[model samples]
Target: MKLKSLFVVAFVVLAPATAAKAFPIVRIDAGQLIGRTLDGVDSFKGVPYAGSAAGPMRWRPPQAVRPWRLPRDAGEVGAMCVQPYSPGDPGVGPLPMSEDCLNLNVWTPSERTEPLPVMVWIHGGGYNNGSGTARLYDGANLSRRGVVLVTLNYRLGRLGFFDHPALAAERPEGEPAGNYGLMDMIAALEWVRDNIAAFGGDPEQVTIFGESAGGVAVTQLMVSPRARGLFSKAIVESGMGRQRGVTLAEAEGETLRSTRARGVAWAQDAGVAQTAAALRAAPAAKLLTPAPSIYGGDLVINDGIIVGHDVVTAFEAGEQAPVPLVIGTNSAEFWWIKPGDDTPYGRFDDDMTPEQIDALAQGFGGREGYDAHVISDVIFNEPARHLARMHAKAGLPTFLYRFDVVSEGSTEPHEGATHASERPYVFDNLYSVRWDYERDQRVAKLMAGYWTEFAKFGDPNGEGRLRWPDLRGEVDQLLEFTSDGPVIRAVPNPERLDLVERLYQKAVREGAVAPPAGEVGTPPQRP
Candidate 1:
């Protein structure tokens, strides 16, 4: 996939007006930016909040930006969204990408005057490659622990989940044709609910966090009713709520018109012309080559306009987003599981059979812990304990955690705490990763003080830590963290999350999972 070499460098220079009066401006609603204050925070960098998903706004949805009448300057980090560059792709070495990239990045707390509480961040790759300018998502030490950190940039691979019936008959009539990257994360949470109070933040005290595919986009923006009040709280770390997708009638036959008819037969096998303006003026490295494995998977689409269901039937009908949640996972998550490739003991190539890996390792208790418990209980500890037991059975305030710490210079069978190895200890960003610097800054100050104390008060139990309870009755209990600290256990494998919740209700009673284009009713009116 050709296009890599960009990484520009000189991130906005022109200073000296007394070093631009020591940087820090702010005016938002689209004008004066400036930023950069350092240690006591402030920062800013690459601000655009939307507009320019590139040429005919790629797959639509985002929009707003265009304002700037001078001031500008936000020093660095804005290109990244034109995917495919591997070497474990996240920050450093190869990113400064393009296809316009819809920006965002803040940090705040330069001596705050009030407002405060904000969080945001969504970076995990897998929705196809990451970058909220990834240097372990530097939100200056989580905005020096006061709150107001944000970090954005959406739209990725296939330019953020492509779909096409001629691009859904050229969109416009009720827009939404395949998760335009979850509507660019609800337009960056409606630009953090209308400009995070001119940078003091507190846009209704937001929270939304992320980890793996930004923790499956904070459980798909907590069951997205166009992302409800745009965040009151949510965390999600390894992410998954029984991840489902494919629907515009199962992506119009075996998915997105069979990947846009195999990218128009590989753009007429490279002679480049089966039009849509010749596959939008080709050469995005000849339209990102590597296709067939039945056109690789996930272009996230329950598409009833920005996912109106299927987050486990909108959290088993309690319809989600009643905020306050922290979710978890990662105790050897993916510990490099092998034996079979498509995990969960299912698809293992080279014509399998050792009696089919001993009948899929005798229902997962053998082939020596069947690829680390079916790649850590079917992709992330039973979909984060079934979305924290459906947000503690809808009575909200759920907490749950399990990190299990690793990095003592990890290197064994890929050591423990595998997948995302606890993202630089939940963004206190362990001094940009080499590891064990005083035990990763004391587990990044106890996981950024239980994530800014659950974004200030939605409860992570304050003053002199350790309590963290909440996942209600029948002894569910959670919080584990480890490396010799935060403990309070109990709920770890509940019979393998009740056998992967009966294998996701037998793949939703055999239709191999589908029900949720907003449960077959009204959803079409946001052109």
Candidate 2:
């Protein structure tokens, strides 16, 4: 993904003061916070979950937030993590940026009987951009569904994922090096577990969900031992499942860029010395280049400790969390996202004959670019099925989805649902995009229902909703959010995805570019 295309998420927080309660206070592990209440939702925006990852703390694990005595005003959105481009390009104006960005936003119903389920949102930017405070992630509607909603900001770009030899050598043994963004997420979840009760949220029922990059993070959290037991349910929207990862200490064979190599290159380009101190001293502004070296395949570095292995490989070994899971892709998932060598097309870029390319392209006969379909299949849908299958094979409750609901609002929306398009529907924030078509509104309500209900009851299905069969209940079954409503159906574009699957297996068996060895064996807590 150019990622600007993917960060294309999943809210604007603007709201009227009509019938609004002025001040609501909540106490957490950090301190007391004063939030504004409007439209039956109490919102605590820019609440710190952990201390800043700025200055010397850069590239390190997130530390506990320093307790505050005074009530902090969490009404304003927090600073976005250091990254390239303002979120949503020109639509949502400039966003705040900072390294002390380990913050989150919360929305809860003003009235609830028992503790409500908690939903922690990890925004998508292909791991390099996007803020949890994006205009599309507003939790007001979802929170009104009797759940506490949380969205967060984590380090992005080199600030988040870079691994350097000097830093690695200097760091203490057993401390996982790369994947700081993932660490930030774990910290946020931990904060939820330790503090959400004060906000009428039951941390035990936490469901972690995201779109695009955020969806990918959901899978990463599943495979990570550090994140074990932190979340009970997981939802991955357009987060391709089959994408592999590079080892913490190893460079990507396809790109000849070890994360450490990328780290070194990043420092050189920023005109800084290669020492750990110099790297740390480098200006944060110069290091904001987002990575797309290989979307899906390039993120969530497989550190031997923090991250055990790639998502597909780990799940194949039954390493993912054995909890209720929801993973799916859109009908035109890659219409905007570009392809890279790490993708199937990129993997076959050099050796694929015209006959081979034609064989793959034959299945996608239409005005829609076959190139986009192939990339979408291999990078999005194919992996989604494989993951759904594996997760279901464990006899765990797993729900898969194919979102193909395109709004007739305007030509401004993609021709198909496309990547990140389903986000508004999930948050029921179609108003953010001026999409008020009845079909669009209906789909948004259905999506928000499925999502919040899943967070509540571990199942998306509820009264009046169509029965979304489990993946194990039927061959390739999934709950598709469409122009109608949630419908139980077979995986979309199966033949294309199957072909891509075969090609992917062939690539692995042929060992053209093998997955990096990450001291793979087994761990005490699954992956």
Candidate 3:
């Protein structure tokens, strides 16, 4: 396949700023010398993409990473932004807390003269937390399969996302930074475009992929004109558009009002004014924590740089990148968000009254109301389906799937495919987890093959793999990844999804969707 080269020259403009070395060791810009440790095949790590987000730059867009006068240590992993996690997942020990956490790692199968395919992975954490350093996200197995794998860390929580009008005013004319995390991803891609060739990766064959919010970010990039030509394909594992719309006015209003309220309350407690300078000078932790709850500072319409519009709006208007896409969700996505033992799909004893059943159903949507089922629908299924539908309607090649396999010895509480469950299988990183290998081993091999196939040829078709279907029609089939083997089946639960589709259409007509539907409209389909 011919690699797209629209922006290859742009990288050349940035190349003079890069080092003149080859694999295992290469220059990123003028200053840094990234180290490498490949298992025979070429793989590199700890390549700085942007300067640190520490101190003053905390909660701001990533700055250019300054090169060290001496060779920087790229061997040890970087600090992961602070986040909450379950007992099984421990925290990164003793890494310094700073806002300057923009960096990327790469892995390749060989150091040969040929430039291999590249896959840049963005980790998922509900717009709040997660790090590229996580064990399950290791790219070793993926690199071994002939693709140069990359994983990166962006600003998270208050440090990566906080925004203020004061900061907006600080912009140089047309540039404003609010979605620092997204900005960090953009900067990383810019670095990749200029530097990947030195790492044995074809800059023209880059595919950006992610899960959950990272997935949402990938789709957002699709709609971002600024991101055009940077990547040739996209893989959004779960984050669809369930919670990704905010106009700059809307976002700014929300931030200003919320920050004022929280700041006033804090001022009353600490006896100080709620002015911008006051807030800025306040103890960083004290000021930052309350800002997110009030203003939702992570992402907002910044007007110029980001176009400060809704993702769905840009996509429907055909402003998004026209790239081959692989998008999908898990079958039992609700299993991951169950609080306590309250699974979304758990059986309810038949002792309930009609009213109770109605209420339960209403909570999910009447039959599928805002209740427990919304957990999966919002985060996984709906978003994935929306991307497929939008791309297919726009005449772009789109592949979809539902991962339905269950690991062997997996208990009922976690019986079906849950969110992020497929990561281990796709990356073939089972060694990082303590799960039973009986069922996982087979599924892992199959899935790893499918993912690598897609990354290699922009299509997940290969010998011994099921013929994956395209997302062209309403009843389009999606590859079902399971232990038995991959099977192309009708998009899962067409009837249920149709019902939800009607709900969205109704909401749109009623103007209930805050981010108004752009030019994109779903033609009425006969049920």
Candidate 4:
């Protein structure tokens, strides 16, 4: 986003105080807010929905936002969640990162009594990094569409999801505190429920939407009983019910084993092993390095708070909220993984061998593994299909789609639609953006229309426009979003998806893959 000048313009001064003071202004907050332009869209940015999770609160559940002494500054952006990233990742640049990054942003058409539909956004960063401050996430365009838009930042990485047995034992009577990150989201929803009316939004008409790991978080909220009635609808893009977390016993055991193997050696070298407090006090930077697979801290099973788990099973059993859902993925979801032949971001090795390919295929679960690397299947296509099936099985209204739009990169069939390639088209912010500015307008209009329409009503199938079919019956009809135009089709390949589902079923049936801690294997506990 273009950085606005730091000097406070006179127009920014909030009303009701004095001429000497300067504060970001919102047009209305007293009466009914009807359809209005950007001039009347009251915006609040960098609002603290939760307390700063720093110092002793780091790696624990979020605390309540304390009362401010002055009119809190909501014009600026908030701190970003901590995560390790170099400049190599596309659309990602080096910026300040921190643990005290639990904040949110809000946009409303007006603070009138119209009670506009609310859409809350959760960002995707593999459960490690992200903020509500990303430029493309700016809610100005959507707010102009007669809806209230909200974007939030949740705790991530070790600060958000580290689980320990000792920590569980320390919980106060009725308060369970594992899955602190998920709780942060629930807390944010609670805050919105109490305060969104001031921004002209109906707390009852809220829709939760997200991408990637954020999508995964949405799935968790859908299945979580504690999260019941928080959101009335959901949108999951490029992420779905794949892996459920493990149990508290499992998570604590894994932490103990992992720390003892890696952290213990460091602790011993530092001459402290009698207590875990010493390890907790170590510099967060030293502990933030990305470790290989299991030992690296990411979302795992936390038995304490995330009870009655396994999101996939929960959905299948009709345990999730029976709300309308739209889920889909990009065609070239994994294409970006291969940046260039010389690039370190792509490929498992400098040279590709049949043996390595065979190993990879086998590791992905035989035939399903072979299908996973096919751009769309892993990131978008398969997950979208899975969500549809689960929702359909439960007899709920579900819409599935495929984003086939491609740029002029001119690779091969594999380069048609990459992961997150559809974002510009979805938000209509492509004009003022960095990538694909000139080419992303129309698609943006169509997607933003679909999303906003879905928010207004429960359906994207509006009359007098492009017809989007609901997910009904056995046939999987997908709304194809491409540069040519939007059309509905019987997706392209079913056999690949069939193979993938068979593999998933095989893995589930035989217990070949363990659910992430605090999940399918463990029973639910009362909070």
Q: Identify the candidate with maximal lDDT.
A: 2
Query: Per-residue lDDT for 433 in model 3?
Result: 64
Q: List TM-score per model, in order.
A: 0.36, 0.89, 0.81, 0.80
Score each candidate by Cα lDDT. 0.71, 0.77, 0.64, 0.64
Report the C-alpha displacement of residue 443, candidate 2, in angstroms: 1.0
Candidate 3 clash total?
Answer: 19
Query: Candidate 2 residues 1-527, lDDT tens each?
Result: 22321222101113213323566777787777767789888999889888988889989999988998655666777778877666353444677688989999999998878999999999887677779887788899999999999999988877887777789889897887778888999999999999999999998999999887788889988999899999999999988766577775555332554667767766777788999888887788777653432252554578756677888888989989988998888887666433333333334344666676666577777324466666667667888898999999988888888888888874634566767788888899888888888989889888888888899989988998888888777769887777976677777777777777777788789863332212111101101
> Tens digits of per-residue lDDT for model 1 on 1-527?
11221111112234435544357777889887777787688787778888887776777778889997666767666787776664443445666678788888898878887999999988876666667887888888878888888899887666676654566655678767757777898898898899888989888889988887788878877887788888899898987566575555666665333445544455667786654555566666654544221012244667666777667778888888898988888787656545444432234223545885576556677777665676467667877887788788888888888888877776645556877778888887765666756766787788888888899888888888888888856347898888878889887657666765675676579765321111111101111
lDDT of 4 by residue, 1-527 (tens): 22342223322334334422334343222222112134666667777778877766765667887764333445666777765542222333444666777878888764355889999998876666667677778787888888889999887655565544344456576564446678889888887887787777999999998887777778888887777888899988776456546554554454433322333444455554435465456666754544212112224553435545667777778888789988888776765343122221122232436685566456446634454453234334665687788897788888888888875533445546766666666667774345453345667778899998988897887765588878766359889888877988986677666655665676578763421121111111111
Give model 4 RMSD, 1 decimal.
Answer: 7.2
Compared with the true structure, the alpha-carbon lDDT of candidate 3 equals 0.64
Return the number of clashes found in candidate 1.
2
lDDT of 4 at 480: 88
